[model samples]
Target: MPFRIFRRVLQLVLCANALRVYLISHSIRRVIIATLGTALLLQVAYFASVLLLVWRAWCNRRAVEGTSQRRRGSDYS
Candidate 1:
């Protein structure tokens, strides 16, 4: 999946230069760029949310681990 994204971003970077030239020469280019930018923004937002959820779950796991560690140490007494 990430490799697919890497290919997409590579394609975007390679195409953007031509897109800039197209933008200056045609009205249709503006609309295409606008649509692509909006779609890219939405994708980025979704990726951020998934990352945030993973981070939150990781923190909760760490907290549980710490509590279990303390309980184990207390048992030695």
Candidate 2:
């Protein structure tokens, strides 16, 4: 009977250890996922800013060209 009780205790200790390890690993996985999500968001924001700058530059160039053409036409007339 004593041997049986000792064996049960040993099993409980092993189970508890496994549960602790699993919890630690789960928490670590969550941290890694959060870090990756933040990095992806930052990258998206960087690209969006770059695209906005390029679009503004293109519009400004078109406006300047249009004004210069109008001036040339008026001068000829």
Candidate 3:
């Protein structure tokens, strides 16, 4: 009977250890996924900022060209 009890205790210990390992692995997987998500968001933001800068530059060039054209028209008049 004592041997049987010993075997039961050993089984319980093994089960508990397995549960702990599974939980740890699950948490690690979540951390990795979150990190990847953050990296992707940052990449998207960087691209957006670059696009905004290009748009601003284009607008400024157009404005300058328009002013220069108006000046030339006035001079002709």
Best by lDDT: 1
**Residue clash pairs of candidate 1:** none
Which is the winner by lDDT between candidate 1 and candidate 2? 1
* lDDT (10s digit) by residue, model 2, range 20-43: 655777675655565556556655
Better of 1 and 2 by TM-score: 2
Residues 7-55, candidate 1: write the lDDT tens digits. Answer: 6875675477447756676767665766577567757876887899899
Answer with 1 or 3, whichever has the higher lDDT. Answer: 1
What 10-residue stretch in candidate 3 is worst by lDDT? Answer: 13-22
Candidate 3: tens digits of C-alpha lDDT, residues 27-65: 756555655565566557657877998999999999999
| Candidate 2 ranges with C-alpha deviation above 4 Å | 1-26
Ranking by TM-score: 3, 2, 1
TM-score of each: 0.61, 0.64, 0.65
Residue pairs of candidate 3 with colliding backbone atoms: none
